[model samples]
Target: MKILQAPFTEEMMRSLRVGDEVAINGVVYTGRDAVHKYLHEGGELPPGVNLRDGIIYHCGPVVMKEANGDWKVTAAGPTTSIREEPYQGQIIRDFGVRGVIGKGGMGDRTLAACAAHGCVYLHAIGGAAQVLAECVKRVRNVYLLEKFGSPEAIWELEVENFPAVVTMDSHGGSLHAEVLRHSQAALAERV
Candidate 1:
């Protein structure tokens, strides 16, 4: 398994290819549809939040607040990624996002952005929220809690060995497209 650490750089992102298993050790921000739309329309990230060469996980985590006001993540599964296809490319370009973590996959526009911007799309396991939350080491900070609420808020998370697989690479490779092409060919033959 390839190890991806903090300060994820262009070279590191480019080195990853489709089907590569990776364990990410660093900070990843939780972003849902609300976050995507907000950023797409030029909304500012919470102060001190930057996406330059950073990873954005498409998740609406299940979080619980503890005494002393510390938050704990009870579930952290990946959300369907295709829904963000419209804004993903733009977000990747505009914010310099190096990696995206989500379930399923994205379309050509996002793939093109990854190719152009040295970014990669990492596919996390679906239906594995509780298991995935084990990788989260800390809940550093959260933003937009008032406007977007917990699920849709910007959650800054520190993680360790968060496992994922590269489904789309910066070199114009997409496992999702491959699956679609193969499925189409099989359907044509059957008909």
Candidate 2:
């Protein structure tokens, strides 16, 4: 298993390939469709949050507030990545994002973007919300909570040993596309 820390460099992204298991450490930001749309439409991010060479998580975590007024992530699972395909490529380029964590994979546009922009897409296990939450060590801050609500808000999180597999790579490798192609061929043969 490969270990990756935040503020990934271009060389780091290029070294990854589809099917590589990875353990991620450091900060990651959460954003779903609403947050992506907001950013794509020119919404300004909250100050002090950086995206350059950063990791973006396609998640809507269940959060709770502690008595000390600190937020805790309860359940954090990856959302379907395809839903953000339209904006993902652009966002990756615009923000210099190096890694994306989500489930269900993405499309050709995103694949091409990864190739061009030195980014990778990591696939998290679906239905493992609670297990994933264990990786989150702390919630640093949350943005757009009032406008987008808890799930859709931008959550800045510090994590340790977050597990994922590389499903798309900067070299234009995509396990999802290969699987789809094989599945389609098998269906045709059965017909």
Candidate 3:
């Protein structure tokens, strides 16, 4: 397993191949459907918050505040990525975000956007809440708390050895589509 520290370059993103195990360390922010909508509607992010060259995780964590008023994520997992396909590509390009972390897979438009914008889609394992949380060493900050509920809040986390796979790459390579094609072909033989 290769441990990758972030501020990942475009070359690094393009170099990742399917089946290559990797751990990512750095700041990753959680954003979901509602957040995307807000952003699309020209909603302003918190002061000094920049999406450019950052990683956006499609998640809505189950969090609780500590006695000292510090927030802690009880459960953090990737949400279904396909739900954001319509806005994802545009968002990525507009924000200049270099990487995206989510579950399931994105579609052709997103793939094209990745290729055009020099980005990659990282796939986190589904249902691995506790396991993923172990990678989150700290919650650096958060935003959009009251307006969009927990789902839309962007929690910035400092991660260490966060495991994920490169499912969609900037070169127009898509593991999900390839797997689907192979499965269809294999099933055709049986029929």
Candidate 4:
């Protein structure tokens, strides 16, 4: 598996290709439908958060706060990425996000945006919440918790060895598209 650090550079994203297994380290941010919709509708992100060259995760993690006020991640599995399709491309472009981690894959617009913006979409294993959470080293910050609620809040996290596969790359490659085409062809053969 290729090891990657957070705050990825454009060159790094461009170097990645579909099907490459990667283990990510450093920081990543979590956001879901509400967050995407807010951003897409011209809502500004909370001040002090920087997304440029960073990773965006489609997830709703379960977190617990300790007696000393530190937060612990209990579950961090990926959410379905397609749910954010309408806003993903624009979000990547606007925020300069270098990587996106989620379950399943995105659509044509997102794929095109990834290619155009030097971004890659990484697919994390679904239903591996607890296992994934183990990779989170710390909870750096949380935003919009009151406004969007816990699950829909934006979580800034520091992680190590977070496993994922490149299903969409900056070079116009998409494993999801390939699978769709093959499935359609198979259906045609049956018909």
Candidate 4 lDDT over residue span 1-191, tens digit each: 99998669999989999999999998999999999999999999899678899999999999899999988899999999999999999999999999999999999999999999999999999999988999999999999999998889999999999999999998899999999999999999998
TM-score of each: 0.97, 0.98, 0.94, 0.97
Candidate 4 contains a number of clashing pairs equal to: 0
Which residue pairs clash in candidate 2? none
Candidates' RMSD to native: 0.9, 0.7, 1.4, 0.9
Tell me the whole-model lDDT of each prediction, alpha carbons only: 0.95, 0.95, 0.86, 0.94
Task: Select the stronger candidate by TM-score from 1 and 3.
Answer: 1
**Candidate 1: which pairs clash?**
none
For model 3, which pairs clash?
none
Q: Tens digit of lDDT per residue, candidate 1, span 65-165?
A: 99989999999999999999999999999999999999999999999999999999999999899889999989999999899988899899999999999
Residue 56 shift from truth in candidate 2, angstroms: 0.5
Model 2 regions more than 4 Å off: none
Please provide, for model 3 over 1-191, each residue's C-alpha lDDT reduced to its tens digit, 9 standing for 90 to 100. Answer: 76667777777777776666778988999999988888878877788567877889999988888999988887888999999988998898898888899999899999999999988899999889999987888888888888778867888988898899989889888999999999999999999
Q: Cα miss at 62, model 3 (Å)? A: 1.0
lDDT of 2: 0.95
Query: lDDT tens string, model 2, 40-138?
Result: 999998897799999999999999999999999999999999999989999999999999999999999999999999999999998899989999999
